[model samples]
Target chain A: MTAHTSSSSSLGLISSATAISQGAEAKVYYASLHPAPSPASTTETVDVLIKHRFHKGYRHPSLDNSLTKSRVAGEARALIRCLRCGVHVPGIRMVDAAEGVLALEWIDGKSVRFLLGGGAEGEEEEAADSEDSDVAEAAAQEDDTDPLSEYGATQDELMAMVGAEIAKMHRGDVVHGDLTTSNMMLRHPRSEKGLQLVLIDFGLAYTSTLVEDKAVDLYVLERAFASTHPASEPLFASVLRAYQAGMGREWTAISKRLDDVRLRGRKRSMVG
Target chain B: METYHYPSFPADASHVHIALFKNVSNAAELRSRIVRASLLEGSEGDLEREAVNFAFIDARLICSRVHLQTAIYQAVLAHAQGALRTKTVHSEILWTLNPSNNISEAIRRYGVSDTTAFLIVVRISTANDANVLANMQAVVSGELSRFSLEGITDWASVKKYYKLNSEPALKIQGITLVQERKIIDEIVTSTVAMKSVMT
Candidate 1:
């Protein structure tokens, strides 16, 4: 009744899951948390997003194992920190470090990038995780309505949600190292915690209290906006306003630091 | 009782049979027998272990079916890797559910207690292995019940065990109690999944 090899169980979950997208560091898959409940019973299993930092042939086996294990653990830590801090991040569903698999609550929503018209030219159209979006997307296109409207948020409010969510994470002292539009999503309007902005991807996130770290986080996101969206100033201003409102008294110093960051670029002037 | 089949696991350990028993009457005797089974020796030990091999869980502590399944999946994953924290995958499931590294604490808190009226018996083995439902019924005197987590979760115990009382996630203004429970379930489920990696 035993004597099974290591790592295959999680790989089994992955094999059952449909591969959605692949990145240089990890591959993402969509799957149910349990085997679909028997057809006789109408109970639906929860869906989970599986992120696997697959094995690399170039690195030694032990080193690869340790690296994969640590990275997966680090990402899980960041996500848990966000969840505890009341940030709108997907809850972690599972973590199997030995297999480099991290499972997250599957978000049924559209990425902010697509809602903002920035997804068309992007490399990773991670905007829509919804498999049933084809019909809704087609209808939205037919009406020529802004996709953001369907989520019940105006562009201004979406930006505000984005800013506030980031502020909450910063308030918790967790910095998202990457803050692209694609990394943030608007939960489907009808789901639990409807139409909220949820942040995803903590692969590079870290804990920090330094105002400089927070400012740099804003700066990186600002740059992402400039490069990805046309006429980005107003959009970024909306984000910062909500961010400033959320940050309250802590906003002033970070704002000044952000301005300084903008002048010198993301990299600070280094001295040996 | 419904069986979940995992296509990826080895044939011997591919399926998990779960039976929820309500109004369990012999939990006290069942608990003592389980203890005795652990201490018995030789062929007698083998027979006793086989008789009560299922992981007997207190249904009140489980927030959602996802919470239970996550533990089972992690246990299977550990068993497959030969890195089980306990002697068997069944115990590993209990350990994962307990939220602490102490094995005894896990079993004592999550295992079937004398007062456990709602019991969940789980067995992971080949799908062809018969008598799973019969065995579960034989070990515990209770009525077979539909599998649903509604109305049974003891929220106070769950929140206290997870230490979610003052956490900011629940402290958010305007959040309903239902919303808070959803958050708790999510946090607890994630904790179970990440037990091995938690610092």
Candidate 2:
């Protein structure tokens, strides 16, 4: 981890940004997009969450550059598509495809997974490398406090938001390849935008209008819930109900396709 | 006038010295001067070019600071990589802001024109910003004002240029004026940020 940090500091934005989490695909950091306003106004700085997809040593440099460039482009494209569709995703702040960096509007809030008692991301993976941050996180997590209550929202409300947002994305013909609770965030209630559910991390997202593709999206999130949260069936039930309402007339075909997807799992049955 | 130093950028192109000029009386003259500077030759050429090196942008089409900064960031990034499509980093910002890849079209639409009343002059410099402000003022004649896009932005021109005329995001009937502008700013800013990859 120290080695990664040292090498990454060469990139201006990533070097200045504070690392938040590290996944296999990219490293996430918090950074401001523009310079701070004059101190007289005392206005808060507008921040962005930068996702840097670092270069791989094993791959050829030429191959690495093209792959990184395309992925950065693809993710930015997906995000803009979702934004145009009115999905509550973070706005794109900047894109440096050459450096494989994407900066998004920094969402001020907690992830749905953490709010629901699933540990914050990278807990086990980061424990060894980042003991200080782990300790700080542990201290922040007080006992007997239901984090979700602080957001002034019920479980049903969050589920509804999640479902509705996915419906909106599907309607836009963009499939969020990775739709886990960790990828969903609820804005702090006191923030300017107020309480809102935000879907994020569009790394694997792609454009597809197929009902089967959309159904598989729901299926992935469903499986994510089952693995991460206990008694998640009821929670996902509310999600589905809200999703059905949002889907409207399109719900019939998707729901039918979803059943087939459930029986055979995410992939469709291949026939000769 | 606002001076922003980007530590992320190298020293040569790190400092972004921007001044918003209102009541610009030299729009036509400045345009010709830039064209003349480009065609200049020898020692006289270098000095004349340096005098008017700042980016003289049409403030009407700019929806917000983010809209402008996104273009500047991409321009500087291209410069750093030695892949700038335009002659200099200053002109590349105009190219980045434009939807199409045409260099002349970008300058014609976003750069200084005859009737440009509000002008934004940008100079990417080293940390040593001595005389940079003076150089900007010497090139363009206008009253310096605080940066703000309120009432200055021509939403119609921005919408037309970015091809948002029929976009569903803006076409929804009865969308409030503020909501419309916010949507435009977001789309325009993002478009500039991803212009390089955008086909």
Candidate 3:
């Protein structure tokens, strides 16, 4: 804790930010870049999400610093690659590699997991629901109407967006190592193209053009769906169908590889 | 003209003033002066350097306001951390804008050229000096206008410089002009912001 406390000066700008979540690697915060304007003022200021990777008390300070720096650099690089490839990910706003802080465009919306009814069952979600009226509205609104329709998309349509976006990213040779429903988001109603799905959290993302890697990427998401959603087999099937269409000629090889992956699991045999 | 104050930056290096100059007739002279300022020595050199302290960017190569802002932000970050690859923060902005690492190549491509018709002049200073704008106007013989990024971009050069013609993102079908420009701007801005980490 002292290791992290000493480095808090590096995150001085984010001192005023609202702490959003705490993962093992980084602490996420929601903040506005500029001072909040007066209520009547029309000045446009976008909010940002700051991901601060604090020091670990257990690791050697020198080793921790290098690892933190590289990870920050790697995540920023992957996000930039996705942006250039036209994948809908958060645009980077600012970076301080030494401080291990990466500030990104704040996405305003609910995670796909929350939209799909999986989030309501969690204790974390219950606490989050009580704290944020907006999240509560999203959850309550979904229960009252067609759950997926609030985003202007059916369940099938939302699955297709997830598939198409991932395919676009794979086409750019960037593999998202972690692909769960929670990592995907639908933009809020006020934004342009409100229904558009955005992929987030590139901390584990890397550049890999291998068909094996791409298949494994999809398989991770497929397993996540199975574990989290009821009657998810058909939902995962629909995602694959859209992904096949988006990949075009490249789909055949990846689809075949995905079948092989399902049979043998994610890892290749080491005995051979 | 627009003045941006970055709250996160140190007090001495927070304010940034940007101005767009169009219909410039002395680009060749300004370019030569910048080159000459680098070689001067002692007190005489200090006076010359102060006269042209701002970053004179080729406005045609800029895709949008965010694109320039991203470069400025990254350059300022590098300056603050003492990790600048170039001598000054102003020149570092030009280095970040270019795709490659060659310093001279970056300057040649993004800096004011003999044929540059429009320019974006930026001054990063401690105080919001009232005379900064006046000084910029006095140096460049051109008509100063509001720093609006619309209608001033040269997309063809941007494509050529970034080598976007071969990129799959830009080659996709049925992408509208507006959509294409938006993609380009986002990519360029992201590239500038992440240049330090770029492999």
Judged by lDDT, which candidate is best? 1
Ranking by DockQ: 1, 2, 3
Give the clashing residue pairs of candidate 2, or none.
none
Candidate 3 reaches a DockQ of 0.39
The true-versus-predicted C-alpha distance at residue B184 of model 1, in Å, is 0.6
How well does each candidate reproduce the native contacts, as fnat?
0.61, 0.38, 0.37
Q: Per-residue CA lDDT of candidate 1, range B65-148, in tens?
A: 888988998898888777899999999999999877999999999999989999999999987888888888879899888898
Candidate 2 residue B122 C-alpha distance from true site, Å: 0.1
Pairs in clash, predicted candidate 3:
none
**Model 2 Cα lDDT, one tens digit per residue, B22-52:** 9999999999999999999999999999889
Model 2, range A52-115, lDDT digits (tens) per residue? 9888878888888899989999988988887777777887877777778888888889999988
Candidate 2, DockQ score (0 to 1)? 0.44
TM-score of chain B of each: 0.98, 0.98, 0.97
Better-scoring candidate (DockQ), 2 or 3: 2
lDDT tens readout by residue for model 3, B1-199:
6777777776666788788898999999999999999999999999999999999999999987667877887888888777889999999999999999999999999999999989999998886577987899888999888676678899988988888888877876898899788778777877787788888
Give each model a TM-score: 0.93, 0.91, 0.90
Best by TM-score: 1
Ranked candidates (TM-score, high to low): 1, 2, 3
